[model samples]
Target: MESNSSLGTALLPEESTETSFWRKVLDVEEVKKQVLFSLPMILTNAFYYAITLVSVMFAGHLGELELAGATLANSWATVSGFAFMIGLSGALETLCGQGFGAKTYRVLGIYLQASCIISCFFSVIISIIWFYTEPILILLHQEPQIAKKADLYMKYLIPAVFAFGFVQNVLRFLQTQSILMPLVLFSGLPFALHFGIVYTLVHWTGLGFKGASLASSISLWISLILLATYVVCSKKFEHTWGGFSSESFRHIVTNLRLSLPSAAMVCLEYWAFEILVLLAGLMPDAAITTSVIAMCVNTEAIAFNFTYGLSAAASTRVSNELGAENPGRAKTAMAVALKLVVLLALVLVLALVFGHNIWAGFFSDSTLIIKGFASMTPLLAISISVDSFQGVLSGVARGCGWQHLVVVANLVTFYGIGMPIAVLLGFKFKLYAKGLWIGLICGLSSQAATLLLITFRTRWTRIDLSAEREQGTLDSV
Candidate 1:
């Protein structure tokens, strides 16, 4: 309570006192270290996106038909997977954030177990999805040629998809600890494995799309193994790997309850986009391929990784400060995160707008395809800017544990209003692909605006540090 600077952007009246303007945007000295922490994460995540782009690059080279089929199948896979997995794994962030905040390490182990169980439970559902991949593609009534190609490509990913979902849960647990390097390394392992194996398998075995999928699947399992082994070996807990107790299970259940709202929030957000892809199918071929532009712009995985990493750090910073009972610092941290997000968004816009022509060339050299992508760059830039806010606030919401409210916001903005309009414009008005993207932009704007408002209104609020008691004297750390 001892300071004020006139220049600071005091978001709350209490924080405004004598704080410098820059300080309002961020607590420079304190947040500096966190910026460093976030940088690697951003880079790591960017690498992830880059890897996916590489995958797409390889597939795109296989011919337009292969590219379209692979992209469609992946769209379905990601959306469906997020429906259950993100909701389930989010418990890790909530419980882990609070646990670290309160120095409640013992309880974190319990939450970890719960996250694992929930992830595994959902993995079963995702695995079974392979059985229906062909059926679902057929139901789309796409040309039989496209459907058949998509089904086979999807089948290859089924095994990998199982491992991928579970691995993400493990990564979440690690991220909560703010020990994200392992998660990054572990996440990359699969990409490496996939590329190496896919190249060889596709060339020699003639499995083509199926082989590539299997490569990705094997890579996921490899990643999972590496991370699980790390958790076992890490010194943070002497007996973390010890068998779970009923009390631990109870604590785990509590963590799940806390995280379920977040899961729903994530699922609803992604599912809306999933619906967009389906609706896009109703358009013409040139129209459908036009989506490849959105997908490409949206798929700038590396760029997104940077934002998500920053957001993750923001969540940790907010949760930790709040748990330490320092609301002022929490407010500062949130501001810093928001500022960083906008800054990052600006960078993305510039890159896309100026380099749209060049970027498309790297992705493909087809003049017709290249021209379509270039035309959409400006809109793509806008979408990227808006999404930056969405990504950041999602972390803010997680930090504040407002999972349910976030979902409600997502539904109202994206589904209740955004999707319907996009569909109407696309079909009725004949806006085609442009209509679809406009709809997406509108929805993202909805999410970003609402999340920013929420973060501001809830400024400096405390994260719940409460947790079920540990099983015994063993959790004293």
Candidate 2:
């Protein structure tokens, strides 16, 4: 009798036999497992972004200047620091996910350590850039007062960058193995703790904006420590983690081959939106436009966490199936993930359409900011829907070791196509924030279409785990 651990191999069967499309799509067992694996991650990501929104809300109430300053600072941190760390850590989604499926469990720990080392090194570079943020913003023609405040906020948040790097590495490490419950527990505790910490420091202690930054940094560190402790003590990780190995140091070049392109792909998408906020700051009512646009971006970011959760699940499923040499099952996982995200996107679009005003009001009581956000809500909804599909496809690409391909696609679609249109319509035509978002929608639509085509045309059987193991590349364990 086959054990439950060997069931994935049964999913392969014989390719000579044909299966109906609907039967593959209606695989209830696979769908159930994917949903169970994805739910905790979705809730955890929602909590993570909610904490960020709460910080932004605290800053928003401090004053218009503080709101704009913190918005710019957070945007910079995301584009320059957090996105890079998350992207770099994503290499593990391929390595560890496949390693687990291939029963090369020890390699998962090695890849996790390698990812942490690289991420910490990058954090130092980002911190230095944060120290000089004021000059950089000024050079970009930002208001001098706002630039100064943004610089201060970034300076206070530097410690959190390193903390966040470890957080992301652990997140990917646990996620690839489908050990998600701890993520929810650990992340939720800090999220609840963050509000009190921010309130006490900001209002009672009179730290104001800096206090908010400090609160967030401290909360992140606490979460990291808790997560680290769990990873260390859990018996489930025993086989995968056999203490820190020097072997981690030897894989720099090999890991970078995936990490760098993954970083670029993520950075391009993230920085594009940050650029939108920066450009909005250059508009006539710089503070108001920046505030409204930032709010819209924040709202969209929360929605993104949902799709991102699905993306992670898709990556894990596809990579695991491919590693187990079940190409048919891998393709089925891709189909089911795409279907799920599209349904989620549709539900989100309706909510945004009907509840735009109420949602905007949560961020600010200012009528002007709320009104501005309302005008752009439709565009935001459309962009989110398009981005939902693209996010899942990118995950598929990562699972299939196509990060380098997607980097090129992102560059051409976002930078080559989207950025120019955004600038031309936004500044040249003076359409401002709305125009910038419209241009972004165009770019996202292009990326989604291209990735879908690529996914469809992929020769799944040719994606061999044996070849990867032989080359000592991704599956080197």
Candidate 3:
């Protein structure tokens, strides 16, 4: 009875043990794959983000009023419009990502179309709000002159909003497929051209401040045109993209369910930070306090762009593996991403700690403002590290189709727990900007911890793709 089966069974245990070891411990190949994936994404995102910033810079050169107006308009546009568009596109990270993994290639194109449609619809609604920026800014207690200038900037920037929506959706679509290299060229090219375009429009043309806003519109459209042309014309997407279809319309409601919660998840966290700036304005030397907080917020945003790539990579890998029915692999991908983001965050925090004075100088030469920012650097460092954790974890949540849960988590942590602590410490305790920032840290930490717990406690299991497609919900496995 010494059969071949007995001999094979004897060797199976060692093979299983080796496989389990790799699964449980650090995975070099997976880390390498993610590294390669994240770098390009970081560059692509940074380039695209700079395009808008460049426009604000050009507008600022005209005068202080133009700067204030452009800055306010930019902030309002982000809170009310850009952030939502980014959130709406997050649905594709789940749908198209898993669909690609499942080899249901055609759905990627359908989801892309559906997401674009949703973005377009929202852009229209948001445009209406942008039209009345002056009143809203006045309602928020902003100076009337500044509010009027912002309205002028926003009016010209409206067309860009629609283009921006499409760009974000396409980004998710391509990112899920691991088609990243093109993104660098698509985004980088426009960003490089944007500077010249802005300078020409603002200086060469007679448009001045208005030219800066219009330049943004043109540059964004350029990005959309390039990306859209690539997706439509390239044979690489032959399987994933079938030409326009009515099927996309059917998926609109399905996409909306996921999109809305995802938008809330992003907006809650964003608005919380914006609120801190508003709170800073209430402090006794309002000018210095507001400037310092705004600088910190800007610094944090720049830092986040670095980790955003890893977050995107995490979402893509987890979703794809889940779609392929490899739960263990999906979990491992998330682990690897978390490790990378933490290490990256450490490097960034070190830079901030050592170069706080230098970095603050870029925002303002006022010694008082610079010194104030220096005082807040350590708090900024802590918040940055905490944000890195949540960024990647949020990506995993998207991969797991848990945006709805994340929305609730953001609300509770930011508004319920974090904000109250901030108000108490900031005002009652007289911690000023530092106290307010500390409160933000509390919220961020709670959110990060909650998301981490969610990732661990929730089972990483295969999604029932057929049932989900039929029911139009990507709930828990």
Top candidate (TM-score): 2
Q: Candidate 3, after superposition: displacement of residue 100 in Å? A: 0.4
lDDT of 1: 0.68
- lDDT agreement with native, every candidate: 0.68, 0.85, 0.86
Please give the lDDT score at residue 178 for candidate 3: 96
As a whole number from 0 to 100, the lDDT of residue 427 in candidate 1 is 85
Instruction: Mark the regions of model 3 whose C-alpha exceeds 4 Å error after superposition.
Output: 1-25, 61-66, 284-288, 365-367, 462-467, 470-477
lDDT of 3 by residue, 98-170 (tens): 8888888888888899999999999999999999998987788766776788899999999999999999999
Q: How well is each residue in 179-269 modelled by candidate 1, as lDDT tens digits?
A: 7777668766666766787687666777766665566566667877988888878886553344454555555556666567877888787
Q: Between prediction 2 and prediction 3, which has the larger TM-score?
A: 2
Q: RMSD of model 3, in Å?
A: 5.8
Kindly list the per-residue Cα lDDT of model 2 for residues 282-317, writing each as its tens digit: 899998898888887787788889888889888999
Candidate 2 structure, TM-score to reference = 0.93
> Deviation in angstroms for 477 in model 1?
11
